[model samples]
Target chain A: MRKIVQIVLAAALLVPAAAWAQQKGGVVIRSVSEVEVKQKNAEGKEEVKRVDATKTKVLPGETVIFTNYYTYSGDKPATNVVIKNPVPDHMIYLDGTAAGAGTRIEFSADKGKTFGTAGKVTVRSADGKERRAAAADYTNIRWTLEKPLNKGAKGSVTFRAKVK
Target chain B: MNTRTASIIVGLLLCLVTALAAPQGAAAATAACTGIGNTASVAYSVAGAAQTPVSSNTNTITVGNKVDVVVTTTDASPGPAVVPNQVDVLLHYTITNNGNANQRYQLSAVDLATGVTTSVFVGNQTVTDAVLVSAGTATTGDNAGAALATTATVAAGGTLNVTIKATMAAPPLTDGAYDVFALRARSLKVDGTTLEANGSSTIDSAAGTCTADVVLGDGAGTDDAVAGASPDGSHSARSAFHVVLNNLSVSKSSAPYNDPINGTTSPKAIPGATMEYTVVISNPGGSSATAVTVTDILAGTLTPVTGTPTWSSTNGGNVPCTNQAVANIASGGWACVGTGWAGSTLTATIPTLLSGETATILYQATIN
Candidate 1:
């Protein structure tokens, strides 16, 4: 009986230590909004400038940009990083806007259950006919990293949506 | 240093610059963004073990004002015969709000009076609730009969009805008095100005795409929405009233009289002669003639005797002529005789004479 009790206590202590090690080698993510503005440069030429989105009131037919930033602040390398975002109501996601280097972008028409490339994701139309999902039909977007994220590495992904 | 040695040194320096300018630690990543007011999150695995996922804050946007309305009138040509000062005309209108939001429409009217020498008299404006009518049917009668509303309420995808009535003034009407009835509608804002598209106000805008009520455009202004052309080929409405007068004819003849001095009888003009005069009246138009009166003047000094005037149809059917005061109108009596006989004139009155119907009067007058 004494030998069995000593074995259980050792196993419990080992498991928590292992979990703490895993937690120390993790990544953190944050998101921010940006807006495109046109202003005249010193040469009097109109130039586009990206600035923080500060507009509290947005009208229909207006477009806004959302960017997700990720940083691996861990003691070990993070692998197979994935990012997913749902499409909001009263807005239309701009087609072909998801972009990042060395990353594979996919779209989901059924929330985030399954994902496919453009013209591959299929869904039933209002008439119950099966057809390829359009950009407007995309309900979620995902980005899959092709390489591991080393410690102290940072990257960002951006997409655009227009108010309906 | 020699030229070849200098060239070798420059090549080495170029190679070093290229190596120094090479991209450092730039990792390729895949990014995708799509959706409105969606949640964005990221997750990763360390050494093949999944880590906790992170989520983004919710983001959202705002849709403005959309306005639509339709107005229409039922009758195109409401053609009917009317006696001047004896008929009231009624017109019907329908206003509909086809938008997604509730709306109020301001109402008004226009009298085209097309080809009319004198304008029609429209009064006692009354409106009532009504259902839509079938094609080619005239709008008449008062369902509600309240005063015309300056503004009418209609829910989105709903309809409201309006009815207007006007009376025709008395005679001096032309044979073909034609006119048009045009009804105008405009959307009013809370401030009573025109509504502009996408404006914050639900009522109306200061400026909009709708120009005239009858103009086929958006309903941003009062003049922007209008009832379409009635079936009568007018944008508003069309009506014609036939006006005409009735006619009459009269004649006189005498029988033989006995001369007191010669004790011989001859059919010659003499005093105390019983002369018979006959009068005929007829209506030859598509309308009935009412309150017909006939007055005769004497060529010579003839005295009207106290007797009932005989009345009959062209077929010789006779109706009794009763003596009553001329002021006693609407007395169902066949005819009215003069109360007291007078010199040089006789009179008769009949209540009504229908189309193609006639009345005859017979009485004797003695020459003085």
Candidate 2:
């Protein structure tokens, strides 16, 4: 009984240390807004560049790119990695904008109650009738990585939304 | 007739509902000062066991005010036909708020400029300024509401009806004369003090916690406004006053009734010859002419004959000329039409000779 107690206490202390390590070097997610700006390059050619949206004015009817950058710094690989984001209030998601490398994109029209790929999402309006969800009806976006993210792996998923 | 009237009323009501329900265009947007923010989350498992989900820092940016509006003249082209010297002619306009916030506008009207001329029947414009009035109803009912230089708060996606009350200024306006006006609206901030700035103005560009700024979104309207910054804070529409005048003319004809030498045979002017005269006034216009006076001065050799003056009016019809002697003028039932004779001088007056109307006066005189 004394030996079993000592083993159990050791296991309990080890679990917390692992949790602390995970907390320190686990997945890190950062959201950024991108704005397209047009300027003359060195060759005097008109070129567009993505700038941080925080430094400029964001008005209605303008498109904003919302990007989530992630990195896995844990010692072990991460599996079933999924990222979820909501279509913010007063903004509508643009179709054909949800993109990530080696990932499958899904949308939720009923606020995460159910999810499906673009054309399969369904929405029920206030009239109690169901209809195929359009890009504007999507309330949430989810991206699932197809492979495990190895330690020190970093990637970004992006979606564009326009102010209402 | 009642059923026909009811149907017309129904049609008008339907139009009113449609106008009130929907604004003209698709410039609607999120309200200004509203914060839009989002936070992302992620879920993962390490070594086949689920780890607690993690959430990112919420990224937020405030939506700025999109200051935009569209102004259009509701009055049909070459609007209401105003006769010369007519006052209080009204023209209608609408200002639709296409912005994301409510707005009050300082209103003004001026002639369309940049050398853009409007025409048909072409005549010089007399009126330059107009007193804007808030329209009380769909119809410009006597230019209702007080003369206003500004408007009440117009909510987003809403419209305000305005009317221009102007005089046919500087009368003696030639027939078909017109004065074109552009009614302009300059947006004022909701506080009623500061004028709204255009997108080109320098403003704090910081993007968090609901900092509202203005972005000009109006197109160059009929007033020839430019599409860029400063002046874009205002929009204008076109309206006009057209002159519709009565065409009136008068003429006199003289003939020999009898000559002293050759009685009733190709009579020529001779001393003591009896002469007959007729005076006619005709109006061929869409409007009526009132208080028209005709006078004839027969100096030196003419003498008036008593009880021979007679007059009649056909009022645009080819009715037989009915005559009543001067002695019966009192009973002619036309108290407004009169002819007076004082020693070879003749005068005729008509009040309210309607459209396409004619009046003729006949009298006998003698050459002394």
Candidate 3:
């Protein structure tokens, strides 16, 4: 009688264990880590750098110069890198040049508010007051480099513009 | 012996009942199975197709002319979806005067499928061509001659910027699907210069492509079917009308003997010497008949006629023939008829006119 009771109890436990294994069907919970957000300054400086407002402050009709340095780090070459800079108020933008690749430049008339094809920029006299606004009335300029920037190599473009 | 036998019998019966219940419980648990089976085995398929690349796209210009080319790609779907539906390729080009003399090249865009070509030169300059295509061939042309082509001096370089936008067609495609397209750019040769055979690079190819699934439900029938019962049991109606006024006379003639010449003459002359105009008004109707009013509202160089206007028999009575009190016409308000014209609405009315009437108001004015 004792042996029979032991056999019945063992069979009941086995039945539950088999049923649990079949229902679970080998599902494993994966551990996932959250991604951190990082912010950096415009000059590519990771640290907090103070920009001298006086150096960057430009007056109307005065020219301001900006130099851009681009370095690629990936294995494949970077062919087209679009660099856009908004034209601040009272200033006009100019063309830029790089050594190896030729440059194609354009400007936007709607302040740096919106950029479009050269023909799309329309300039009409605001209230017909003799001042003409046209596609030529560009506030932003863009340059496309003809040659690709190789990995680990740096390229630079220089531009000069006058304040409006 | 009696007590032991009874106990044994009860035990046997209990054992039999438990055996029957155990199998039933197992069957019930198995019947509750609701697993997803296998997701990997359920495959989602998409129709993969290859599109022909653009070849021989060209823009012609004068010696110092520029043109822009925009290349765009479209997916098979026409409606908006969660994924990107279009891509843009901008090309800024110029015709340079490299030779000893000036040359001209005709510019055109050729439909790859139909082979029908269209000229694209504006005035004496080369106009950028924007091409839209589905899964077929496309190309543009340059360098036909002094005839309707781009002309440029050898030393001058004309600048142009081209933009192309490829829009996807209707119907949503499944996610992770792609549509392929090609762009071909070639220059036409004029004079002794051979056309450049090495076409420009492919603007875009099949790279990152994605789409989303969109489901639509049946609502009211789209065609002229009634959506709901109208409150008044009347069918809604929509109509439009236009009226043109012609042969009206406006001049700076001498003032009538009874009226005083209190206003000054404008320095600017009336348009066409005689003020003859055609008035057009459109009414989109609902419950109210849209008011159509015509008023002469000119400032500075434009002055209204001193007397009332004469209307054709078809004209509505809204515009009076005599010079009434001046009223202010709100920037976008109706013509003020009676007394609101004192401040800024001189020479115009302030009341909203009703629909389907032709009212011609004649006024005279001089430039300040």
The lDDT for every candidate, in the order shown, is 0.49, 0.65, 0.27
Worst 10 residues of 1 chain B by lDDT: B5-14
- Per-residue lDDT tens digits of candidate 3, residues B4-123? 000000000000001101111211111100111100000110111111111111111101111111212122222111122222321212222221111222222221212112212111
Better candidate by lDDT, 1 or 2:
2
In model 2, the Cα lDDT at residue B367 comes to: 90
Q: What are the DockQ scores of the candidates, in order?
A: 0.21, 0.33, 0.01
Tens-digit per-residue lDDT, B1-368, candidate 2: 00000000000000111123344465466776667787899999766656668999887776777778777887776676766545556667788877777766776555532344543223345333333334333332223222235445567777876666655544355555566666677777656656677543222212222346677776666553343444476787777666666657767787886788987677677888777676666777655666666666776878776553333222222222223212112212333234566656665566656667776655567799
RMSD of 1: 25.8
Off by over 4 Å in 1: A1-72, A97-102, A125-129, A150-156, A160-164, B1-36, B63-149, B152-222, B225-368
Better of 2 and 3 by TM-score: 2
Estimated TM-score for each candidate: 0.43, 0.67, 0.19
Model 2 misplaced stretches (Cα beyond 4 Å): A1-24, B1-27, B112-115, B118-123, B128-153, B169-171, B188-211, B224-231, B247-368
Ranking by TM-score: 2, 1, 3
Q: Answer with 1 or 3, whichever has the higher DockQ.
A: 1
lDDT of 1 by residue, B1-368 (tens): 00000000000000000111111131201001112344678777665556667676654322222344555655444334444444334455566554333455555444443333332322211122222221224333324421122444455455665544445444444444443344545555544444323334432212222221111124332222323322211122223333333433334444423233332344344776545555555566545666566666666766655554332222232434333212122223233434323455555655566666656555555557
